[model samples]
Target chain A: MTDTSATSAAAQAPSGVVDLLGLLAYAELVSFFRLSDAAGLAPDLAAKGELAGVAATEYRHYRMLHERLAAMGADPEAAMAPFVEPLDAWHGRTEPRTWLESLVKTYVGDGIAGDFYRTVAEHADAETAEAVRGAVSETERAEAVAVRVRTAVQEDPKLAGPLSLWARRLVGEALSQAQLVAAARPELAALVARGATGGDSGEGGSGGKGDLAAVSRLFAGLTEAHSARLEAMGLSG
Target chain B: MTDTSATSAAAQAPSGVVDLLGLLAYAELVSFFRLSDAAGLAPDLAAKGELAGVAATEYRHYRMLHERLAAMGADPEAAMAPFVEPLDAWHGRTEPRTWLESLVKTYVGDGIAGDFYRTVAEHADAETAEAVRGAVSETERAEAVAVRVRTAVQEDPKLAGPLSLWARRLVGEALSQAQLVAAARPELAALVARGATGGDSGEGGSGGKGDLAAVSRLFAGLTEAHSARLEAMGLSG
Candidate 1:
């Protein structure tokens, strides 16, 4: 279900590449802000310092993505603008309430997003893909978040139910916003489409399962990875 | 005023150095959190990116200061614990309501702090002092904050009156907190007293102006610099 205009545009230009870069850059920028805020939510000074350190890396990643967009002659803000509202809405709706919620968000929610982006990066140019990989690299703070979550749930078995529900909600909210973004940005949709019908085979290949089927496959892959992450965290999807 | 205990301690130990480093390290950590929060208050994505970038530098500075403390066999969290309340109170009492107010806080509030710390750093051990200097160095985002404040005030002359009052409040709140921190940490007070009496001339000499008078003089110098900074931003102190 490629939009006719998006198909036309995808045929002639690489707006999808620009859209993808823009989305990634904006995501990094937002993560920088949110992760730093999460530092304040940390229960201890050591945790705060660790989260703050993690937040800094997000900014570095944002700079790299912005630079890549600019080198390609795109106004970074303009490129990123399209995804802003959806992302903001997702964050606004999914505000973490407690320190544990914040940790879970970082470990489970961000883990899923990181995986999705890594998959998308596979379809990008070499440099873009490398930047994506670097940006999504989980630091020790993330590992710490995972450790803390596992310990907390193990100590309080009752917490697993609430946290598991929270994790599911996070995934639901994330996927909803992702759909919103894809619906609004056909160029990005086309990029996913192109990536789906075999990499570099161009958008809407002759016998490909069309955009909707390809997008379904992409979501299925995302869901499978997300379930694996939840199970690792001792939570059911 | 030198407490009898602080004077005796200062004569035998470098607790003053630890206090100074601790204050600075904690300051960087809090700034990392708040500056990143400020990025959310930015009016545009570009400004958001810039503020977020500024926030990242604070974490790097925090790491350097934390490393210095760790190298000195100090527990970073415990060393930082003492000043946390005063700093948190200061931030709580002077929370910025608007984007412009947030900018003013960073430009005016943090400017005064950076200057005061630089002056205090001069009294510390060379390595600690060097680390202090490195942590407080302003990046372009700070400059951009200054420029934005100046331009906003210039564009709306009416804004100056309220902003000027806000600047005064920020300084007052900051000074009040500084007084609180100084009163609680006698070792830090002793460092100021020694620095005031002229560095490396021993703790107490016949030519010294005693602790109270010397502290008054130090505040005077800090006040003068603060006033000059406000004037540079076109705000009356």
Candidate 2:
């Protein structure tokens, strides 16, 4: 009794939301690979073990995101395919060359991504929002890495300048990628717009095409936190 | 009052065991790294996850060995120093270049090492023997890798020749290294000989020094297992 065309259309539903999920899933996968690889650079067994522990946590996150994508009627691999090239390229371009660089990468990159997810989760539906909440909460491990870096930098003033510069580049490239994703996916942009401008408030705002305010708030919070961390490490923000 | 010479000698009493324990501890650490790195070559997430699980198990072994070494009145770092260069050289020389090569390395190298440990464990005192027993039993995960490789090789006849050659080379190199260790430390070699020969049967056999019988038995069992695995994979022994 159902129209064949309608069934096909349903099956081929626009997967903009799925694309966002895919992005997050691939991010976790690449993070796992990078952290696991970087663990080799640790100077001692204890530090190596700690880094390996962090790598294991990243794999756990990948599994969770992968399952969520599968539950939403998308092939996790196919959904993940489009984003892999860009994500890989980004990591390739910014591969950390030293122990401090590795820690800074985790602190700045993961910190901003976690903040962005927290804001996005607030605007998402319950299930997806809860997933984002879980992901952001897991950033505690990354915070531990940041604390280690902070302690190390404080003990040696010479480390501060290079690490601060590394942190800046990490944040800059991450923001550039965020802009690319926003421009590439209209549905994702629409989702952000809806989340940012909830209710029909046609007040001073132009047609609520996107939520620049929400975006700015997320970036500002992340930048402030990072700057505070740099200052604590005796580095200029 | 204690003589200064006697006190200094007592302070250095466990130095010899430190080298042996350190080698074992770092072996486990490097195994964890190599296995996890090689896990990337798996064709699917499920397979990759399984490999990661095994690699994590290696970390547990590394922790145990490390703790034991620390408890034995030795600085684990100092203990592990001497073997670092040699083991690192071995790994560098035998780095697997492809996925199949990695699997073969895991199968052949781990299989022989497990057999060697089983033989060595038989000679160790109660506590050391128990620890070795625990480590040997952890080989089940590595065995799974072998079984998977065997099945894959069976499915593709063309894979048989190269893999067989690879397995032979792996075992050959492993045995070469074992001989190197045997020749490097005569006292440790004597300890292994006593363990292998069991109670003062000290018939001391022909050498009146090291027992070749025990070494032969260990090598024979390893060879049998290795041949059976190669046969199972449809490759010549």
Candidate 3:
């Protein structure tokens, strides 16, 4: 009976994995569109080009996820279909209207998301962990843009208040939607919980931290990193 | 003295080729952004995915042009810089507001431009001609989108009038900006002239027709093609 249950669980794991990958894939797709559109909001050509380069990197990430999903025997389009509306609605509601707003969103939103992925990656299976790690690595470019924005804001302190407020709103919106996603997918939540317990040998739970504790650590690290970045740019920590 | 002059001109030709390649490179970059943005206007997830796939193919073209430009000892960015303002201006002035308008712009604008490149390729030297041919050949995806749009319009005759008007405007705007580019770069104009005149016999330019006559033939063929496409879609020719 235990063996049969284990076999059934193993069979079910792929569907959960497919759903997770599909969600991430669509997120990257939508991110590409948003970043590309945001490129037009840049104040100058070099900034535009840099943001476009970031956008291009997202396309590469999209392609990798797409190939992996196909290899896993799921049509990427079909896998991505379920989350499109909610994701689109979130982005539509949070569209940034200025260059600074866009940068802040990239910085705050992507930074925390990267950290969450890192936590999840610790408990995922080998292939799943690898995919998440690969995607998270691309966040560095967006981080660099954040650094640039911090430096620019330091040079003009009057811009600081507005950008900081924008960053706060971005995080709030992201957290809101993330909770929605988590609520909607119980299997994913359970997978995340297992990873958090440090009991799963897979990437998600391999970090030796409880779920809430792991999340707390992630937020702490992100906050410290952002503070250091801001200080390095001669801004308030 | 003759040898010195010939060597200088030969060296200069590569720079000209780089300019041509760079123009195509930036075109691919912008086209990727535009097509991806336009995909958001798509009514269905499948249509959106299809448009995104088309956008991704443009990056493949960009990589090819970037590699060729690097081989020719030219900085692709610098070569592309001169054309950016004109191209940006053209797109900014003719932003598509509707799904049908976006499709019409893609079909008419890209189709006509591809035709022009075909003519230019015939007049280019061996390597350059091959590059142009390779770049133009990547239009298969865009052509597929055009066919889909035409069928969609045929199914709904109400789409015919607005889309036809949009197509005309797209062509008109494209021609106006192309003339601006032609007037601004006399060397590029000279290259077009020389190529059209069949001056590089090393590439075997003609069986019977002169360069100008060949160019005229190309234009006629392109016009007829677009007319047939439009007519098939139940739009005004």
Candidate 4:
């Protein structure tokens, strides 16, 4: 964390909005790249094309957040630099081994991340929140993921066991990384912390009681939304 | 090929038009995937993002071709399925080892591809030609590729040698696989053959004289264009 990054984040004040946008931007780009690779696992061309289309939506979101960062006079790349390792580590650790696993990751994994980004964005400045929401509004592809997974599970019930396990792994890896990020950048943790308590509790020192408590609440909501998503695919989340 | 595919191709008449659209669609998807992979080699985040933007253009073009196939009552997946192995082989063999090599492939390789597609599109039916032209018209990203490759070459003169060799290998691999595609789908060969000759020369048997002669001409023109592109980057074509 250089003073310049601190200043960039501080310039956007309420602290960590630049971090938020930067994190989201890098996440989108990585997601797009990963999903394109996952298309190879698709059963057919229709599935492959649909998967590529979904990934393209992620690139569009990246462009939006990237532009937002630049407009704020923050170097988009510099802001994003702080995030590359953690995100890459998370994706690396959770590489999906099959088409169903990939779908579950896309659905269960991206589902929660999108949910988490939205929860934090709502508390940022009006424009930041709007920009984040606009970038994050990728519901249609999520529907496509849902239909494919649900139908596949319905066809062969055996898939439910392994896929449900895969979803758990994806969520587990995600929270582990999220915690690492929170530890490294307390202000971001505090930003979401403020949203959860509707008070200034996260103003405490790094990884303080206030920060962990609020993040727990945020993650709790995300967990619930997608356990239901797993169940919708006949999987035990 | 199956009797059903032959019927479909026959229904399209001119034999190779379905093959053309399908080949083009699959090509776009594979190019998009390769470019996404190449983004990882970018020197900085700006270059990575720009590379990704070019990849997205390929996806949009893929969507365009896919939809056009469906509108013609042809299965988009089926049309693209046949070219999958050959296209995948070509990409796997020619993986770029550096950012400049990737840039050259995008600029010089895709440069000629867009040219060849446009040249042939001009000879197809009005709507088919229009659709092909629309998807293939990706000039802006080409400008991005040219500027980056040219600048990189200018700054470090030594890059020109290997990059020039890489461009030649790229064109070589492209022609070798293209010939494989031609051998497998004579109708498509005939389609481009007619485009080059401006006569009904490709109407003979598979691997016919007219087909080979015309394809040579089409490829000759593509080669000339990209040799110029390579020179523009201070490399010998």
Query: What C-alpha lDDT values do all the predictions have?
Result: 0.70, 0.63, 0.62, 0.75
* Candidate 2 stretches greater than 4 Å from native: A1-21, A36-40, A67-74, A116-138, A185-208, A211-225, A232-234, B1-24, B36-50, B71-74, B116-138, B186-208, B211-222
Question: Which residue runs of candidate 4 sit more than 4 Å off their true CA positions?
Answer: A1-13, A194-209, B1-13, B194-208
lDDT string for model 1 (A119-219, tens) is 45776557667767765675323666677788889999999999899988988898788777766665566565455444544355323435455455556
lDDT of 1 at B96: 81
Give lDDT tens digits, candidate 1, residues B57-171.
7778789878867766667788899989988888888888888998888777567557546655776557666766765675323666777888999999999999999988887
Scored against the true structure, residue B167 in model 3 reaches a CA lDDT of 70
lDDT of 2 by residue, B1-237 (tens): 233443443255322344555666777677767775675577775566556666666666667667655554456666676666666666777878778788777766666546545544654445555776787888645767767777888788788888888778776666566556655654434444444334433234423344455445435555677887677555676
- Report the C-alpha lDDT of model 2 over A125-151, residue by residue, as the tens digit: 466678777778887556677677878
Which clashing pairs does model 1 show? none
The alpha-carbon deviation from the true structure for residue A174 of candidate 4, after best TM-score superposition, in angstroms, is: 1.2
Docking class of 1: medium
Task: Report the TM-score for the A-chain of model 3.
Answer: 0.74
For model 2, what is the alpha-carbon lDDT of residue B7? 41
Alpha-carbon RMSD, each predicted model: 6.0, 6.8, 6.9, 4.0
Model 3 TM-score on a 0 to 1 scale: 0.74
Q: Name the 10 consecutive residues with the lowest summed lDDT in model 1 chain A.
A: A1-10
Top of the candidates by DockQ: 1
What are the per-model DockQ values?
A: 0.72, 0.20, 0.31, 0.65
Candidate 3 chain A: minimum summed lDDT over ten consecutive residues — where?
Answer: A1-10
**What fraction of the correct interface contacts does each predicted structure contain?**
0.96, 0.04, 0.19, 0.59
Better candidate by TM-score, 1 or 2 = 1
